[model samples]
Target: MEPPNILSSIPFKQSPLNPGELNLTHYCMSFLLSIPWNDISVTGFEYLAKKYRLDVFSDTSNPNEVLLSLAGKIILIDVIIPTHGTYRDIRIALAFADATGEQYKNTGAEEILLSAIHENNTTLLERNVALLAMLDRCSPSVQQSCFQYLETLKSTFSLIYTSRLNTQAFNDETEIIMSAEGKPLNDNDGNLGLQLAFWKHQDFLYTAKISMNELPSNSLPCALYGSNLVAETPLKTSGEVSWLPETTMTQIPATMELLFEDYHIVFPEFGVQSLLDFLQITDLDLSENFLPYKTLLNLPNQTTAGYPSMNKSHIIYLGGIDIPSRSVHRIPYSHPRQILGIFQYVRQYLTLQTIFENVKLSSTRITATASLRLNLIMKQYPVIHIQYQELNKLSNVDPVIANVSVLPNGIVQLNSIACGNTPINEDTALKIQKMLQKTLNIGLVLEFAIPKLFNNQ
Candidate 1:
């Protein structure tokens, strides 16, 4: 007898939502509804129902649950509004463990709901809650619509409103697993512990373990928004990146290892220089707020930061709007992403040499042992300007391929440089060498390879 086929033994099953078996059980979602008992204007809800021509049906049996029929699909949502409050709106939150489950299966429900929220002119807190409830909760088919619409809404809203939206939205697709065991500094009798969180995406993985010096609960509600206590302060945190990415270099010896696709860089000894570099970068004044988040996350889901989704990815730190004096000097683990994102924006305005000088002087030694990662996915390489002194002008000194690395002592090492198959005399090589050294204070070691010009230039 022939061996049984394992695949054929199992029954093929799929949800009727899509013929290809659209499974969205993992897309858990939560909703928050803040209704001021005194001011319950149904205008926005009415406008949305009228505009979409959606049929609304209230569950007579259960007052909290309501059903909406849209495009031949039923969206049954359960919301419980509080009957009483002192001086603020009563807040109620609903969680959908399976966003695409039978009860609430419509693909475009989030878009419709967001439109309703926008029309209602809801309070900032309520609006933010509603927005968070919908992030990564919709079906794949409706992602673009929901994301683009949110982008539009973000543009029209206040800079501070929904501050966490972009950060949360950008990282929505990446799931994080965390474990915590800690006590705040104020609790003298308690033991101070650590919190570890891990997130892994396509090309890389990262783990951050941090210890909180101050409890978040201790943060005062300085910024009040829509009757909710939304604190604008960041908790004091000290942590280390226990994995790759090299974005947050470690201050502890052998605490982390950075592994690129082809190169492996190691760091020894404590170095707060990169963190200092980061702080200096963040201190620079930015004329426009929220530009980094908007520019990076608002684009279509097809790409990230103007590069293919596979080629580019990001991790963000939603730092507090107002940094407390006590937490200012503390190395807050949750600030790099936003800092890096902002750096991406302001880097263009600054001179290249300035950045290079800072990186070179940083005590955080970044020395590579393996070869350079050949699979570089940059959008475009900046033009290399080498002033040729007009001594014996040789044809524009064509683009060259080189392996670049920063030495353990901070000097940049540009080795195995190649300028196509062309053979050059000592004078030509010496000229190229002198120009590069003069401009970048870096020397080169040549290795021949094909030279290619990019961007049609």
Candidate 2:
């Protein structure tokens, strides 16, 4: 059995009133006038009709119940007015409820009417009540029109209620149920069922639905009737390969275990004497290193006899190098330069050796564990390390460093020189230390190493 489309079951009648000529105010007044009020006073009814410019009492047959009926209709539609003008309006509006002995009751139509009269605005109350009453007898098209009109009025009365009714009507006409897997299911005995399908292509997913219903005259799917079931188009993209410029070396243990046996090779502990021996053996001249230290040390000796004696205060320590006390024999200026030269050479050599060891160990570990197939692939592509010496170099133009200490555990400690002209302050030093620790994931300690004189001196 073929099921009928839900849309065909809803009755859609045209309204008698032309859409363009609809006026809510006049419609409400007219609806009130048509109601037969058979329980109202002749004098009071005439007063109300005159107040609103409405002619509702032309043929008053039952004077006793005429006003009562009018009040009942007004209350039924929930019309209300404020009590601004001396109890006159409230007295007349609640007259019917009061006469029927329902004025003081806590619950019922009468109490609601009395509350509405005391609280709500009369103008908005009348328009909303009239619109609701008229909508009951209105055709679907006319109801849609009236709904639009009520929206523009912004009365905040029956707008939500009327919109809900429209939505209910739409839902009833279109009975669509979508399953959890996004399949549209139709239990109705329709001509044929439609099925929606999805397919994944590369990184994107595409969706389409097919129906057995008769195709439209201009549909392109009809042209492929007896030919291939599907068609394909190639998508274009740039063929360039992209690579990350910077990659970190994974952290390996300081010591590694061997399957068969273990052996360790400790590098010779080179000192200042070893460096001196190397310099002498290589026949390297130490004149360049001695020049800067010598110039500074000779300042006091060269001063004229009449000139004020240049004390320890005159000698400024750059690079945070400690000076011997006056009482103790002063070491020759040549010693410090020799120490510095040896320190610089050893530091550079150790840094390079560490890098070589790390790279070699990493390659050996990878080769041992990799499968035969992986080994062949890896042999074709060898590991390469890119070294940038200046990547972490400090700016020589600012933030002068007095001394630097590199610990065995990969910690680099810096001491800032205390000079009146030096740019680095406590705050700037702290910031640099934190940034270094965060970026390199290493320990960094900063200290101000100013030279202080003892009381004995």
Q: What is the TM-score of each candidate against the true structure?
A: 0.20, 0.15
Please write out the lDDT profile of model 2 over residues 204-254, one tens digit for every residue: 222222211112112111111111111121111331112111121121111
Q: What is the C-alpha lDDT of each candidate?
A: 0.25, 0.24
Q: How do the residues 118-201 of candidate 1 rate in per-residue lDDT, one tens digit apiece? A: 344344324333233333222122312223323332232222222322333223323212111111111011111111213222
Off by over 4 Å in 2: 1-68, 71-110, 135-457
How many clashes does each candidate structure show, in the order listed? 0, 12
